[model samples]
Target chain A: MAESDPHPQSSPVEPVSPPAPATAPVDAEWHRMSPRFVFVGTLRQLRGLVIPAAIILITGNVGRGGSELILIGIAVVFTVLAALGSLIEWWNFRYALTDRELVVRSGIVQRQERVVPYGRIQAINVSEAPLERVAGIVRVTVETAAGGTADIDIRAIAQDKAPQLREALAAARAQARQADNGIAEDATGAASTVATETPSATTGGELLRRLSTPELLALGATSGRVGPMAAVVGATLQFGAEIMPESWWDRIPWQQAEALQSVGVVASLLFVIAALTWLLAIGSTALAFGGFELRRDGDHLLLQHGLLDRKRRTIPVARIQAIVVGEQLLRQPFRRADIRFESAGGEAEGAAGDSGVLFPFLPRAEVRALLGQAAPEFATDPTVPMSTRLPRRSLRRYVFGATVGWVVFVGIAAAVLGLWLHRWVDVVTWQQVLLLLMATPLFAWLGWARWRDGGWVVENGTLLLRWRSVSRQTLITRASRIQRREMTADPLQRRVSLASVQLSVASGLVGGHYGLAHADRHDTERLLAMLGGPRHEVVIHKVPATVEPS
Target chain B: MATNTFDAGEAGTSRVIEVPERLPDPLHQLDPRARQLWRLGSAISGAMFVGIVALGTFGAARFLPDFEMRWAWLASGITLALAILNAWLSPNLRYRYWRYDIRPDEADLQHGWFTRTRQLVPMARIQHVDTRRGPLDRRFGLASVVLYTAAGPAYIPALANEVAADVRDRIATFANIHDDL
Candidate 1:
C-alpha cells in the first residue's frame, strides 16, 4: 500500500542523509565508475549534434561558403562541453556498499543521494551499449521496488568488478532477507553456494531459451513495427524531398517507371515504401534483439540479449505479476505469439519498449514448455485457448460490440466518399460505399472469432483470460499479485446477466489493467473471491460493530 | 555530516507510523437513517433540474429572434417528465443495492444500480480511509467512508456517524495486524 504512492521514488532518496563533503576515511570504500565512461559519455553527448552538424554540412553549403568553418567551430565547442560534463560527472559519481544499504551520491550542484537497502532492491540490470562494449565497460542500474525511475545508475564500471559487486550485494541481501524472515535457515546452504564463486554466473546458470538465427528472423519478419515504421519512412521521404537539390529531383526516373507499368506512380511508390519499411523493421529488430536468451539462476531469471546494445537483466521470479501472450495480425496465422511478463517492476519493457517481451516469437503449442521451464507458475494451462469461453447467448453482444465501431466507421466513410466531396461523384461511386459495407460479413466473422477466443478461468490461485481484437491476447496472472479487481455490467449486459471483470497490477510507470467483456455473473464473483478473505453471507444492517449500541 | 543513512537500523522500521494515537470510543451510536434523506435530496435535485432546463431553453429562445418558444417548452416538458420518474423511483433502488461489510480481514462493498460493482479490499491493502460529512449529509445525520487502496479508491456511502467511526478504527486495527506491531 505504501508502494502505491505515485511518488514512491521520493522515499528512497529521502532516507539518505547528506554525505560528508571531502571526508577522507568514510570515502575509502567509495567506488568510482570506470574512466572509459568519460569517452563513451562524450560520444553519447555528441549524438545530439548530428542533426545540426548535418544541417551545417549540407544546407549551409547550399548558399554559403563558410559552412565548413562554422561546422568545425560548433563541433569543437560541443566536443569540449560534452567532455567537460562527462568528466565532472565521473569525478562526482561515487557509490559505497554497506552491510545495510547501497548508498549512491551523485551530482555536484543539485546533488542526488539515493540509499537502497539490500532487501529493497528488486532487480539489477547490467548492460553495455555498443560504445561501452567497445570500451570494455558496462552500465549497472540498481532498481528497487520503487521501480526504474528511482534507479541508481552507475553509468560505466569495469566489466570485471560487476560480478563481485553483484555477488556481494546478493549475499548481503540474502542475509538480510533471512534475518528479516527469521525462518530461512533451511535454504542457507543453497544461498551460500550461489553467493560465493559466481562471478561468471551470467552465462554459467541454467539455460532456458535462446532465440536461434532463424527464429530471430521470424520474429523480425512477423513484428508489428512495420506499420509504424512505414509511417516514419513516409515522413522521412517527405523530409528527403524537401532537402534534396533540384538537380537530384530532375534526374529521377519516376515517370519512366510509371509509364512502363500498369500500376500508377502512387501505387508503385507505395510498394517500394512498404518493402523498404519492412526491411528497416527487420534490421532494427535484429539490431535491438539479436541473441536473446533467457537463463535461470536460483530465485531469479537472467535475460541476456541484443546485438548492437548488449543487455543483461536479472528478474527475480517472485517479482513477476502476470504474463501476456500476444499474437500479431500477421503472426496469428502462423500460430505464433510473443510472450511478455507483467512483472511488478513498473517497466513495460525488459526493457526494449516491447512490453516485457521474454520470448519475441514463440509457437502457440510450445509456449507452455517455455513458460514451464522459465516461469512454472504461469504455465498452468497450456492450450490457453481451452479455458471457460463466453456463453452462446453472449455471441450477439459480441457481434454488436464488434459492429458498433464498424457502423460508425461505415457511416463516416459513406459521408466522406458518397456525400462529402462534390467533385468525386463519378470517381467515388455509391458502389464503393456499398463495397465498404461488404466488410460487414468479415466483421461478423470477427465477432464470431472473438466469441470463440474470449475465455476466463480461475483455478489453482491463478487467473487465466483470453481475449482478442484483430490479434489475440492471452493473460495469465497469479491471484495474490492482483492489485485491484473490479466487476462491472452496463445496462445492456445487465439484461443478459453478462459482466466485465478487470484486474490491475503494478506494472509500467504507473500500472497496467486488463479485463474481459461478457463474462458470466457467477465467474466474476469467483474471481472476486480468488484473492479475497472470508466470504460472509449477505448481512444487511445486522452485524454490530466492536461495541454495543448506546 | 551523517555517515550512516539510517541510524535506527532495520528492526525499528516496523514501528507504527500511519496510526499514531488511538481514538476515543463514542458513547452514542445510531443506524444510518438515510432513505427519506436520500429521496428528498433527489427530489430537490429533480425539481431544480427541470427548473433550470425550462429557464435555460426559454432564455435562449428569448435571446435568439428566430428560435421557437414551443420547442423550448417541449424540451423542458420532456426533461421534466423523465426527472420526475427518476426522482420518484431511483433513490430507493440505489439504497437497496448498496451493501458494505467490513470484516477484520477485508472490507467488501457491493453496489451500483445499472453497472453493478463489487470491491473486496484486504485490510493490509487499505492505504487510508476517510470519513466525509457534507452540509446536506449532516442534515440527514449521515456520512460517507472512502477507502483508498494502492490501485484506486472505493467508497461506502451514507453511513451513520457512530458506524463510520467504528468502521475506520476496525480497518486501522486490521491493517496494523499485518505489520510487525
Candidate 2:
C-alpha cells in the first residue's frame, strides 16, 4: 500500500540508508492517509467515469428496449466491478514511509508494488476537504524523483497519523536535500529544530474569506462566460420555434403589409419563448457563479467551492506554471476578474477540450499577492501603467473585418430575400443597401474599441499581454516556461512591416498580435529579440517564501 | 582548456574510458528463473499477435462489408509485413545499436538505424534515472535504463549486467550536486 492509502499507517515500514547531504537535516514530516479516504475517493472515482458512461448508454438507447436492456446490464456490470475494485483497492492499498524507504502496494489480483528509496523521494503534498475535516482525514500525494506516471496517492488516511508519516517523509526529504547539498550523513542532529510550529489546519475565519454574498455577485458579474451562454440559449430558443412545423411559414407574404399582421401570433410566441430562455440562462449563470472563494494555507493555496460536488484543491505555490488575469466587458466597471493557474495533468473537463488549468477563478488582488509570494519577479507588477496602447495600424484590420462583415450580411440577405420573394432584381432596395453601407462604419467603431485595449509588455522575464473587448485580460508568464514562440506577418501586414507574436506555455497559449504600424523595423526586431531571450531576464527574482499581508 | 563540444568525427581521438563500476544494467546477475519468465512472456505475446492476425484475415473475408474489404486487406497486409520484418531485423538492429559509454562529465548513447541518433545528456540536466525489467527482459537477463530531464525522456535497451547501479548512482550524484543550480 502507498503511504497515501487511508490505512497507510498500518503498512509495513521498510528500512534503507539515507544519502548524505551538505546541509544539516531539518525535521520533516511526510504524510499518511486516513482510513475513510477509500470510501470517499472510490465514490468520487465511480462518479467520474461510470456516471457519464451510464448516461451516454441510456441516452443512446432512449426508446429501444433490447439495446437499453443491454446498456443497463453493462452499466450494472461496470458498477459492480467498480465497487468490487474499490473494496479491493481499499483493502489492498497500502503505503508507509520508514527511515529508509517509501513503500506502496496496490492492485487486487495483479498485486502491483512500488518501493521508493528515501533518497529518491522528491516532493510531498497534503490535501484535506471539508468532509475530510469532519472525519479528521487527509490525502497524502508523493512525487518520486523518478519520472514517468508513477506518482503515489494515499487516500483516506487518519489525520493523527499524518504528522508521523510527514515526519518520516520530511526526514527522508531533508536527508535527500542534504545529500543534494553535499552535507554529511550524520547531519540529522538539527532535525528537531526544523519542525514546523504551525499545524496543518485552517481557521474558521480563513474559510469565510473565500466567499461572501457580495463577492459572489461580483464574481458573477465578472464571469465572462455567463452572458455569452445566455445569449446563445436565448437565440437558440427563439429560432428553434421557427424551425418547427407549427411556425406557419405559408402565411408570410413579402408583397403586402397584411403579412406582418398575419405573422403577429408567431412573433408573440417567439418573444415569450425568448423571455423564458433569458430567465433560465440567468439561473444557470448564478448557479455557476455561486459560492466561490480563494485562500492560502502555508506554502499551498486552497481553492474550494461548488454549487454541486464541493471541491477543495491545495496546490503548492511552486507548482504553478503561470497566472492569467481575465476581465469581461461587463465586469470592467468593478475591475472584477478571473485568475486561473496552469498546472500539470489537470483534471477539469475544459482543459482536455482547451487547455489545462489549476484554478479557474480568483480576485485580482489575491492573484498578485499569490504570485508575489511564489514567483514574485515573474508577475509584472500590476500597478505599472501600460506604456503602449493600440497603434494606428490596427485601424486597417478593423476596416477590413468591418468591410467583410457588411458584404457577407448583405449577400446573405439578398440571396434569402430574392429567392423567397421571386424578385431577384429588386430584392435589395436602395434603402437596405444604404443601411449596409452605414453599418460598415458602426462595425469599424466596435472593432476600433477592441483594438484600442490591446497592449503588450516584456518585463522581469515575464511577458504580459492585456487585451479585451469591453472586458480586458492581462496574461503573465515566465519566459523559461514558454514552450513555443512564433512571430508572423500577414501579406498585408508584411507590406506594412507589422507583425504579431504568440507564446505557448505548458498551461496553454498567451497570444496577442501587436500591430506595430508606425514603429520602425528595428524597433520590432529589438522587441522580438527581447521576447526570445532566456527566461531569467523576464522574472528576476523568485517569490518570497512568506505570504504578504493584505 | 575546456573540452570542445563532443565530436563523433574524432572517433579515434575519443579515448575509451573504463565503464563505471556501478552501472545501471547489471540485472543479469538475478536468478535465471526470472530471465526465463521474461522471455516466455515475450514469446507468448508475439505468438498471440501472429494468431490474431491470421484469424482476423480469415474471418474478415467473410464478415467485412464489401465497401470496407479493400481497406481492411490493405491495412492488414501492411501490418503483417511490418510485423514479420520487425521479427526478422530487430535482433541485428538491437545488437548493432546497443551501447552505453560514460565520459567524465556526461553520458553518451548511440542508437537507431535509418535515422541514427546520438545523444549527449549533460549530467546536470537529468532530473532522475530508472532501471526497469519487463517480462521479456527478465527472460533475456536484460534491463532498460531510462533517464529523465525536465524537458523529456530517453530510453536505453538491452544493457549488460552491472550497469544499472552505476547509472543510478551517477544520476543521483548529478541530481544532488546540481539541484539548486
Fnat values, candidates in order: 0.12, 0.03
Tell me how candidate 1 scores on lDDT.
Answer: 0.66
TM-score of each: 0.58, 0.43
lDDT of 2: 0.50
DockQ of each: 0.08, 0.06
Instruction: Give lDDT per model, in order.
Output: 0.66, 0.50
* Candidates in order: C-alpha RMSD to true structure: 15.9, 15.5
* Superposition error at B66 for model 2 (Å): 5.5
Task: Work out the iRMS of candidate 1.
Answer: 17.3
lDDT per residue as tens, model 2, A448-471: 756766666767667776665445
CAPRI band for model 2: incorrect
State residue B53's C-alpha deviation in candidate 1, in Å. 7.7
lDDT of 1 by residue, B1-181 (tens): 1111112222112333231122111122123355556777888898999999999999989998888999899999999889878877777667656766665556767777777776666665554455555556656656567664434566777776556655654554454321110
